[model samples]
Target chain A: MFLREFWHKLGSPKWFYQISTGWMIGFAVAALVLLVVGMVWGLAFAPADYQQGNSFRIIYVHVPTAMVAQSVYISMGVAGIVLFVWRMKLADVAIAACLPVGMMLTALALFSGGVWGRPTWGTWWEWDGRTVSTLVLLFLYIGIYALREAIPDITLRGRASALVAIVGTINIPIIKYSVDWWHTLHQPGSFSLTEKPTMPVEMWAPLLVMVLGMYCFAGYIILARMRIEILLREQRTQWVRGLVA
Target chain B: MILRLFFSELRLLSRNKAQVLNPLAFLFLGVMLFSVGVPSTVQSNGIYAGAVLWFIVLLTNLLALDGLFRRDYDNGVLEQILCASEIPFMVILMRIFVHWLHTGLLITLLAPLLGLALGIEAHALPVVMLALLLGTPALSFIGATGAALTVGFSRGGVLLALLVLPLFLPVLIFGANVINDAVAGIDNTAQLYWLAFISMVAFTIGPFATTVGLKISVQLQ
Candidate 1:
């Protein structure tokens, strides 16, 4: 009675899809608007680092992508807990949609980081904690995606892959802290929910914008993908056929 | 009953000698090839030496781990183990234990020779071996957890690598760090203890997950 009806509606796929559409379009528009803003600011307006010069521009994309890659996995873990606790099938499907986007963002992080590293660290690769651990996060995302696609039975695959995703969640913090704890070239966190960004407002304001923009884009991409995944996986189900027609 | 059944599974593993040795051979051969291939300059630097050694070890670990719980899934042994055994959990548990004893322990025992080839100092051999002894089991166990989670499907062995290796990172970090520190004549006890703690935690908790995973894998199969 106290917190009931709102949460209850989310249990149904139709309720969720209908409800989420508004959020999806809103996020998509917001992401597009901010992506143009962030890129323009980052590529054109943001001042170059005194140390690394133009290469530091990579941070605008790299850090945000890596950060979102991590948050997406954390979201998937929460989805796992949701499904495991409430047996919400839709939550599992939603979690499935998060995997590839997380992976792509991880790839973006790695690519941008690697390019940034060529100038900063003077090496294409290093076993420095943050670099190596972020690389591992990329693998974990691939594993989640592969596990889902590998199994033929959609529902069963969803459950099994969720189990793997939940287990892999243990590594997220390790990746985050590895940069701080270990002797590494990678920089530490900025703009955390609790902690203030280390840089001045000039740097972090744009960073804050990029982070929010990426979150919204991630939302849009995952929702779009989930709609596709549902259509593909549920092609044989009565509801899906009705929707298709 | 599970012990008897588990031995049969081990026998099934050994019966395919290629399965067991191929990966380990890849480990050895890759190390040998890399050692041969790298310019002497890079090989001389301690930094590159350690990175290359760990990289080879990681790759070999992946190769070996690809076999974890795979054949049994193929043979329907996993399904039988799930349904027929009263202590099916123990059956999954016992298989992983035997796997560690066989693969992890053997690789660890061989780490010194590897250390020697990789230009690791003689004094550091002990630390590297100790790290491997504690660390490889963690890899094997976590790998089995991933293997169990992914066993029934096509393309899963490769996917299993992606899934499990990230989980393998902490041990790699500490294991390599401990070795690097020991070589530098620095105290590495903290890293060593952390690696062991991770191994212990995985050992205690991994079986239950593997058990549930086996059930899920088999049922889906």
Candidate 2:
């Protein structure tokens, strides 16, 4: 019964707006503080790698962004499933809001990965497993966004994009596995996600902070977009009119 | 009932001999472009031959998928089937099967000729055909979902490619790998097994998703 009421309240845009405003502010401030501290520590205070020297500092941005990129896609998949099963308007909003954020974050991860690679691998792009998977993730994002644009009807667009997103979710694991296999067979001496990082605690701690900061930042952006979507979708409603007037 | 639907679709599709021949012609031209245009020296290398053949097969599959459901959907045939059948999902599955039969299987049958054009050795020809025979059904199954989603749109050709091509990568990777390994005189059994596994999964999930997409398209119309 309590769960039911919570779900009902969640479906209410007005209630969501009231609750998320505080969340949005809190997360924005938290993300800002954490990112600043983490960056300062990682860039200046963290000890340089014995092998990689200061060039290794990029991982503080690279690894965290890469982690969040995958997480954000998974969250969109969950939202897609929720949209189909419950027909909740908020779930659709979540998917709509996450695509751009996920796309940019994935791009950031790829860019940072490339930067890191230039120092470590002697090249800007290597068709390795993680890099190829991230590239595919970017393409999937483009596909979903394109599908949404092609369909004109709002409800139909929601359902169609939702289905595409869901199918993409199922394909992600297979893609990762196949890319990994292809990479292993094609290039024996290459970076892989399975290798254990030998970095010390001091080196990794700031990365932990950066990852948390990035997640909070992504949440704030997604929620802010959700709020704007709510307003746009509900512009003609009495509650929205009263709030505006 | 399934046979009745299957035969009817087959009969209708066979009447339009051009549609059946279209993908085959595309496959032939695509192989000629690569082998003839790129010069013989590069084409004769069995490894490149294997990759080029699989890539051409993938593109040809995409070409054939454009009409998988558009004609039926446009002519009110799909709508009537949905309204009349107790299980409309079978209609989609059968359609995809017939599509694979015409485009995919025929391509597989003709793959040896393309393989020879690319200078693929005798040992690799069987593997190339085997990979296509196993992997192409999955393409049809997956393509059906994209077709169903975009069937409502008047112009869905490029959009369907965007939506479906990324999903085709794994199939392409495994199928190509199967032949590439064979050309290198390595065991390709593992890749073939993975290709079969993917096809099974696509067969199970494709029809259900396509049915849902078709229903949505029909309802929106």
Candidate 3:
């Protein structure tokens, strides 16, 4: 019952705004500290790969951004479901907040992967499975964003974008699988939960930190954006007017 | 009632000769552009021909999709259908079925001729038709959802392509791979199965999503 109440309370924009300030600061600091520590360790301290040397350090940036980019999309999909099933307005806000950030991160992942590939694979780009799927992902984000921008009605916009997000989520795995089956020039992922890490502790430990930091950073950015969106959306409300004034 | 609706849709589509012919013309034009742009030496490559054929089919399907719901929505037929039908899902499903019959099925039938023109081997021509036959309905179904979503906009044509093309990638990949495998004398059952699986999924889900989209569009109107 307590958990249910908390969930209900979290749905309230005013309550969310009131509570998220502290969280925003905490996440901001945590993301900064963790990312700095992880980047410093991974980029400067970790021993280089014998084959690719220091060029492999790009993984520290590439892996985390890629992982976080996909995670944000999945979360938006979940948010899409919540918005549809529950008609929770905050869920729409969450999607709106996270979308541009996710698009940027997906772009960043592609760029970093390309940069990493130039040295390791001797090409900046290849039409391989992972790369193609990631490009599709970026397109998916842009499509949803464009759809949202095209619709002026708030309710229609919310529902249409939510539906697209849900459908895109279902298609993502199928796309990945089909693209993988079509052609696979990229190496299999180095990180998997079911198996042990291929690299040593010194390398992966920093990666773990980087992953966590990226998540924290995403949380901070999304929350900050949501709070502002909430205010703009609710600018006519008494609480918002009082807060703003 | 469902059969009546389906036949009526077919009759309505048949009345508009341009609606049916334009996409076919576009398909022919697209193929012509590709044949002209690429050297004859490259055109004979089976893999290249297969990819080009699949891409042109996709674009042709996309060309036809913009009109899928726009006509109905514009005339208030969609709103009336939604309001009157006991099951809007069936109505939307029938609409998509009729759409596939005109666009996807026609394109599938024409693919062999186009494939030959593109220098796909005589032996592989059957595979091109088969792949397209298995694949184009999925395109129609998936593209219908985009059409439904953007049915309200005056300028939804470009936006529809933007939204639907990415989703079309898997179908395009599997469909083209089936032809490529067939060209090389490799068994292509797996790719055909994948296309069938995608088509089935789209068939099941597409109408429901399009119904929801229609409702949203109607509500806005």
Q: Which regions of candidate 1 fall more than 4 Å away from where they truly are?
A: A1-4, A36-58, A114-128, A176-182, A231-245, B1-67, B153-156
Q: How well is each residue in A75-119 modelled by candidate 2, as lDDT tens digits?
A: 888988888888998888899999899999999999998898888
Candidate of highest TM-score: 3
lDDT of each residue in B19-125, candidate 2, tens digit only: 88888888888887876677545635566776788788878888888888888888998898789988888877888999999978998898888888888788788
Compute DockQ for each candidate against the true complex.
0.47, 0.73, 0.79
Per-prediction fnat values? 0.57, 0.55, 0.71
**Model 1 RMSD vs true structure:** 3.8
Can you tell me which runs of candidate 2 are displaced by over 4 Å? A184-197
Full ranking by DockQ: 3, 2, 1
Between the candidate structures 2 and 3, which one is better when assessed by DockQ? Answer: 3
Q: Report the Cα lDDT for residue B176, model 3.
A: 81
Candidate 1 per-residue lDDT, tens place, A1-245, comes to: 65688668877676666677798899999999988898888888887878889888888898889889888988898887777778887777788789889889988888888888899999877767777767888777777777777777766777777777777775566544543456777676666678877777767777778988999999999998887766675678777667658
Model 1 score (lDDT):
0.77
Clash pairs, candidate 3, are none
Which ranges of candidate 3 are over 4 A from the true structure? B41-43
